[model samples]
Structures are given as C-alpha cells and as structure tokens.
Target: MTELLLVGIGTGNPDHITLEGRKALQGADLILIPRKGPEKSDLAELRRRIVLQSVRDGMDRVVEFDLPVRDPDLPYLEAVERWHDAIAELWAVTLAAHPDAHSAALLVWGDPSLYDSTLRIAARLDPTPKVRVIPGITALQALTAAHAIPLNTLAGSVEITTGRRLRDTGWPDGAETVAVMLDGACAFETLDPDGLQIWWGAYLGMDEQILSAGPLEEAAPHIMRIRAEARDRHGWIMDTYLLRRTGVPG
Candidate 1:
C-alpha cells in the first residue's frame, strides 16, 4: 500500500519547513509538487528549492504535475469538488508511474489542516491510502508574526473565517478576534470599522511581503491599494488578516 504524506511547507519561506517535514521529504520515495501556471511560477520554484535542499543523494525523485484549474462557470463549491477529483486522479496516475513510490509526499502550502483542501482531495483516491500529516506554520501565524501582534486578545476568542463568510454574516455575534484567510474580495470593507483594528499581510514571510495595520478606518484604503498593486505585480496573491473589534468584551 502506498503511504501518502501531506506535508505542510509553510507559506512561501523555505525555512518555514519544520524538521519533521524535512524528514518526511527525505523519507519519501517520491515527492509530488504542483505547478500553477506561469503566473505563479515562483510557487513551483520555491517547492523545487525545498526538494533540492532536502534531497541530497540516494533519493532523488521529485515530480511536478500541472494542477487542475477550477472551472469558473460552475458554482464555487461544485467547481472545487470537480477540481479536487481531477487532482486526485492526477496523483493516482503519478503514483502509478513511479512503482517505487512507496511513501509519496505532497508539499502543501501552509498547514494542510487549515483552509487548504489537499487532505480532502487525497481522500478521493480509489484505494484509500495510508496517510501521514506533517504540520507546518500556517498563514495566520505568519501574518501575526510579521505584524508582531498576538492573534487573539487577552483570553479572547478568535474566529477563523473566509472573505465570503465575513461579507455574508457581517460581524460574528460573539467573537472579538477574527482572522480571515483566502479573502480575494477584500471583505474588510463590509465591516463598520468604527472601533475595529486590522492587521493585514500579503505574501507573508517572503521577500515581497506587505504588512499593514492600524485603525481599520484609516488603514483600510491603504491595504486595499497595496493589495491591488501587489496582485497586479505578482499576478497572484495569498493574504491573511486579523480583525479585532476594539472596546468589545473579551
């Protein structure tokens, strides 16, 4: 039976790879890396660097596969389901091609347990494969670390949500600290921002990282402009943010 290792490699920093993740890379018979077109070429190159550094000799089989793009015509969730199925098929084909790949490693961005769906996709394999998950730094942690702020207020709760949820739900009923990830729509604007503070980071822990924070009212415009410029420059952006309603009960 093939053992599938979903290894989290952190945001974009090579150093973010944990010691256990490194060991998993070395132990793997083959490493599967995804290429997300030329616009996101840097992502693939970063994975390449990690694999090159982790594999010195003896075990030198790292394969790259083009990731399937989600169809925009279908509803978001449905498209994602179809995309994951295709990705699982790709993984199965790749694993079949490498007979010696007893333990295959898939380099996942951020922690697989977070907003990422790699683990869900892996479950779609025809024959359920044994799984090993190696955790790494998540984008939320990286965002907070880059901004030098704690994710949650003193003994306060933090709500992890997406841009879509924030837009739909306005503000959560009880949570004071909200960390939003995978927010392409810039949902921060939907909030009142009267007493809210926001810490936003893009391409966190990388050379092109942009961090901005202040009273949400004041900093919102700047973050919007910066996020737009960064996305334009890089053709893609991965960002996470922390929002706290000031003066709210903890």
Candidate 2:
C-alpha cells in the first residue's frame, strides 16, 4: 500500500512551512503539483519553490498535473463532487505511472484540516493509501497575526464560515465574531454595517499582502475597490476576513 502525505505549506510562504512539513516533502517518493491554469500559474510556481527548498535530492520525483476545473453550469455541490472525482482519478493515474513510488506527497495551502478538500479526495483512492498530515500555519492565523488582533474578543465566541454561507444564510446567530473564507464575492456588503467591525487581509503571509479594517460601513467599499484592483493585477486572489459585532468587550 502507498503512503500519502498531505503537507500543509501555509499561504504561499516557504517560511510558513513547518519543519515536519519539510521533512514530509523530502521523504516522499513522488510529489504531485497541480497546475491551476494560466490565471493561477503563480500558485504552482510557489509550490515548486517549496519543493526545491525542501527536497535536496531526486528532483525527478516531482511531477506536475493539470487540475480539474469545476463546471459552473452544474449545481455548486454537484460540480464540486464531480471535480473532486476527476482529481482523484488524475492522482490514481499519476501514481500508476510510477509503480515504484511507495510514498506520494501533495503540498496543501494552509492547514489541510480547515477549508481544504485534499483529504476528502484522498479518501477516493481505490487502495486507500495510508494518510499522514503535517500541519502548517493557516490563513486564519496569518490574518489575525497580520492585523495584530485576537481571533475572538476576550472570552467571546468566534464562528468560522464561508463567504457563500454568509451571503446565503446571514450572520450565524449569537456568534460575536465570524471569520469568512473562500469569499470571491464581497459578502460583507450584504450585511447591515451597523455595529460591525471588519478586519480583512488578502494574500496573507505573502509579499503581495494587503490589509484593511474599520467599521464595516466605512471599510467595505474600500476593501471592495482594492480587492478588485489587486485581483486585476495579480490575476487571482485569496482573501479572508473577521467580522465582529459591537458591544463585545475588548
């Protein structure tokens, strides 16, 4: 049976990779890097840099494959499921090409346990490879650190949700603070700005990082404008934000 290592590399920063994550990368017999199209070529390049930095030998073990794109026409959940199946198939095919490789590794952005689907896709492998996870810094941790703020106000609760959920279901009831990820749309615009404060960061832990914060009403438009400009310049973006309601004691 093959061993699959899911190594968290954090948000595109080579330094964010933990010592354990680097060791996992070095130990793998095969390293699979996904090419996410021209718009996001930088992502693949970043992974390449990490592999080069971590793996001192057998550069030939590193492999690149095209990532499957989701069909926008299909329902969201259905599209994601289908896309994941395609990725699993690709992984199986790649692994089959190198029968001698007993250990394979994939570098994950941020901690694999949070808002990541790599583990789920690995489950679809027919032989069910032995899975190992090497944790790394997460975007949430990077965001809070970049802004020099705690995830939650003194002893208050924090709810982590996606941008789509925030736009669809509104703020989670009784959550003093909410952290939103995978938000392509500025979902914060949908909420009433009253009593809300926002701390937003994009490209967390990278040199291209940008940050914004303040009362939601005052900061929302600025965040929206800058987000658009940054996406235009960089061709893609990954962002996260924390929203806290007023009346929560600091």
Best by TM-score: 2
Question: Considering only N, C-alpha and C atoms within 3 Å, which residue pairs clash in candidate 2?
Answer: none
Candidate RMSDs in Å, in order, are: 1.4, 0.8
TM-score of 1: 0.96
- 1-250: candidate 2 lDDT, tens digit per residue: 3799999999868899999988898889999999999999999999989988988873678989999899999999999999999999999999999999899999999999999999999999998999999998999999999999999889888899999999999989998999999999999999999999999999999999999999999999999999999999999999999999988997
TM-score (all chains, Cα) for each model: 0.96, 0.98
Writing each residue's lDDT as its tens digit, candidate 1 over 1-250 gives 4799998999999899999999999888888889999999999998988888777851367888898999999998899899999999988898888876688898999999999998898889989899999999999989889988888888888899999999989989998899998899899999898989899999988889889999999999999999999999999999989999888654
The lDDT for every candidate, in the order shown, is: 0.89, 0.94
How many pairs of residues in model 1 come into backbone collision? 0
Q: Give candidate 2's root-mean-square deviation (CA, Å).
A: 0.8
